[model samples]
Target chain A: MSLINSTATEALDLLAKGQITSVALTSAYLQRIADTDDQIGAFLRVDADAALARAAQIDQRRQAKQPLGKLAGLPVAVKDVLCDSQTQTTCGSQMLASYRPPYDATVVARLKSADAVLLGRTNMDEFAMGGSTENSAFQLTRNPWDLNRTPGGSSGGAAACVAAGMTPLSIGSDTGGSIRQPAGLCGVVGLKPTYGRVSRYGLVAFASSLDQVGPLAANTTDAALLLEAIAGHDTQDATSLDAPVPRFSAEIDRPLTGLRIGVVREHFTTGLDGEIEHAVRRALDVYQSQGATIKEISLPHSKYAVATYYVIAPSEASSNLARYDGVHYGHRTDRAELLDELATEQKELESAGDREALKNIDNGLVRMYRRSRAEGFGPEVKRRIMLGAYALSAGYYDAYYLKGLKVRRLIRQDFDAAFQQVDLIAGPVTAQAAFKLGEMAGDPLAMYLVDLYTVSANLAGLPGISLPCGFTQSGLPIGLQLQAPPLAEDTLLRGARMYEQATEWHKKKVPI
Target chain B: MAITRADVEKVALLARLQLTDGELKMMTTDLSQIVTYVDLLAEVDTEGVEPMAHAVEVSNVFAEDEVRPSLPREQALANAPGRNERGYLVPPVLGG
Candidate 1:
């Protein structure tokens, strides 16, 4: 009977029937966010006035008998990586602290078109780097389920907001389990659509090849609803898939009677915490009870997914983030006098940087390129960038980048071969439940291992969804991931919906 | 277990980032720990096991050699910390 905790579908039904106004609904969510956000750190920015204004428009249209989109004023939080025209979209970095984009990301534009109220941007690991939100330069978004524990990141804030009931859904970008891992730890549902399934045109890049935008919501249906609204061809993104967006929600009731679920052998390794494994097993029972067949399959190459992901992700990130030098965008120090005087500028920039990078920057007339790059990027971001530059660096491209490419092909082949024999792949979303905050900070590799179970999907270009299947005795939620072949998002959703309906894990709310 | 001061400087230069001696000393330890942890990869025999690059097999991505609209010069230039009349501004490097 609670209005705030109701699913998006239920909320939409109420709005369509005039049982509630978008203004009222948005206000209610805002009130909840205001009460809980200080404790949860879910939002990096909240524009109460903007949210209400948008909601008022939706209410007005509905009263006038005009058409309404499916969401129709639902409030959804967006990750900081996505652009928000009215808010400064700093991706947890001091460099972009004061910058605001003039245009909304494609997903944001779609949400606006659907009449969804934009709640505000949420916190994330700086440039979506760390597994725990601890890497955020601004704030650490505490896990809603257990504040003492981490909200698995870099979509940490978005996931925490939904789990804390700040919003029914939120948009998050996943490069490597950024959406799903947090969704699992926070006890929410997160969907990582196939790469290119959702447009990445406006997403601030972390790793170009691996980066993707997806939705994190309270339940499978809500997640599906958001996906339906965001998925489609985006002319602005060259690599975006041109396929028609599927009716994700419509498949909620799709029969799973003949589902052939593949239990990935590698997911059951000894490194997995016992209770998490149990939860996955329990969730698997849902399919078995529904007359679906379960088969154990080997993705032997999967053992190396994390290793492959780190190298490739950082390498790509190194390249993609190369644009954020102190010169062109986001963060600069004053002392720059040469920009006005051509001769002075030429003298300064020419000697300032590497010849190759200098070509990209204008220093007086001579132009300096790499020097600005030298100043803008952070150490963690820079380390990866350098690795990428070196990978794509002369003389090493074939040995490093090309070798990585070959391995990527092999990884995809493993998934391709596995998908042919199974309707879907099932496993824990992470190696174990969320670890203590700062536990992995000193060991970046340990943090990356948190993504071992989830990164394979990114490496293979497949759709994966993570839902709270069970909980550890310590009370941490465990995610059961369901992955399907490329463009098989519906299968993953359908499988997840079935499991969700069969369990009460989704109903367990965080006492925010 | 320890990254030398020289190691930190080398990495900093490679990354095109600056670090003070004090920061360098701290990073030497921190970076060394991280490097050691990631060295777990060394345990696995990846011989002939090609390194995976992506989850999907997408190759030769192409764009029509066509010009399209881009963000305005003003918006693109909005985030820069240093800029002057013509373009972005930077610290002096002529001494180099």
Candidate 2:
């Protein structure tokens, strides 16, 4: 079997047994990426030299009879949203196009410590704003299953890399279903760890309160392995919880006897694609057959998740993104300089009865800030920033932001109540499988609706996982989503493993 | 409530974004549609529900008041689009 096809766990075993060297394994993925990435567009950047160096270092460690890290030679792709000092981290935006951080994200640092080969930065929705990676300013990541369709996003490229067999694992940040939705569409295992489970130190902030970086892997075992490596508290991130990290791989084989799987009634309601709903229901049956009980539960306020998320996420995004003015960092507008020159002309023009010439020139610090941001951010980003600014603006905060907060409480309470009766909730990851590229591009709201099932997990800060369960008639992959109450990743992964083991769905590869 | 073109322009200004007239018109429609959808939240009676800021209830997370290593000046300024010996250079503050 090709090294790319082996799971990270199996590959690590092979590396340890001297059956395969890290250099050889890394070279295979590098070659695969070079050969296939043109069609897939899964990566924003690939550093062949650095990747080989890291792999050679791992092989040297093994040859010297030294202890190796858990992921000694595995090639892992990282979403561009995560910072890596070794490569440029663009967050898929033109604003950060030439920008490179001096430090690696905590997750990236952890992956390196585990001796994993850093494949490259994967494409994402710019600053992880949109559902489809078409929002990416760089390139569209095609679903490996069907080259015409989206890979689902903002972690589209990460999931596509795994689905295309470029890498066995990739890391992605989930903010309103970015990771899981893409994972579902790409037919891979994507886990969004509980909020605060992973450090967000070097993750470019999208919706700070909602974003959590996690693993996207070819299989549940590899997903769990990757999650274990990155999940922990760090002093750098204030929200990162000090909660004890579980050995997720060790708990993967846990039997699902009497596990109460809650099938959320709300998720089965209107707008879910028929094939996806059927596959998820069938997945529930598999769990039922394996001694797990499926119960109908309700997250009554979950209907408000998308709306609440729209208000909350963008509101936070507006505030979080405010730091990107030209003076501090990111793209600076030459318009500011031109405007300054124009202001001088404006004074003379105004005196000469040509006030119209001064319309676009506001030559001050305020002008620099506005002009830089205007040039830097994309349309969707600007739309979100405007929506957030309006929502949090003076007259609307109480009606919009505050009301969204109240509904957020209700959403969390609903999940809290449901967890009392069930260990985990199961549903479809998205309303449909990967949609055709540009399908929902004209309608931003339609794209937001695609995240209906997955956003509730982020709304309530719950851990969620999307595992490939079945496919549509058109052969597009459908994902079954499993969510657990906050900090209940152990239960969430255990439940997903039960379904993953009972079916060979995960073993089915995209014909990339 | 339908977001008007003026409303979008106003929000755009507040967001430090400069939108063209065409973008403003499009944004008006888009924001109106989004607002119409999110307006659904008003239907759910959130009576007595407290506002939630975050998923997990975290009090002020205080690090020890000790100085630690921070990013070196060059590393911190590496991604700056405009910089000089002092720091990131900005447009004139006074327009003088």
CAPRI verdict (incorrect, acceptable, medium, high) for model 2: medium
| DockQ scores of the candidates | 0.30, 0.75
Candidate 2 lDDT over B1-96, as tens digits, reads 798887886787788887777888889999999989999988989888899999888889999999888889988877777788658776666544
**Prediction 1 TM-score vs. true:** 0.89
lDDT tens digits by residue: candidate 1, A108-208: 88988888898988999889887788877788889877788899898999999999999998999898899999999988999999998888887898888
Candidate 1, which CAPRI tier? acceptable
Residue A328 lDDT (model 1):
63
In order of appearance, the predictions have TM-scores of 0.89, 0.97
Q: For all the candidates, what are their Cα RMSDs to the real structure?
A: 4.8, 1.9
Give stretches of model 2 more than 4 Å off. Answer: A335-337, A344-361
Measured by TM-score, the strongest candidate is 2
Q: Write the per-residue lDDT of candidate 1 for residues B1-96, one digit (tens) a residue.
A: 345677566545555555556656666665566445444445444467665554444567677888888977777667666666557665655532
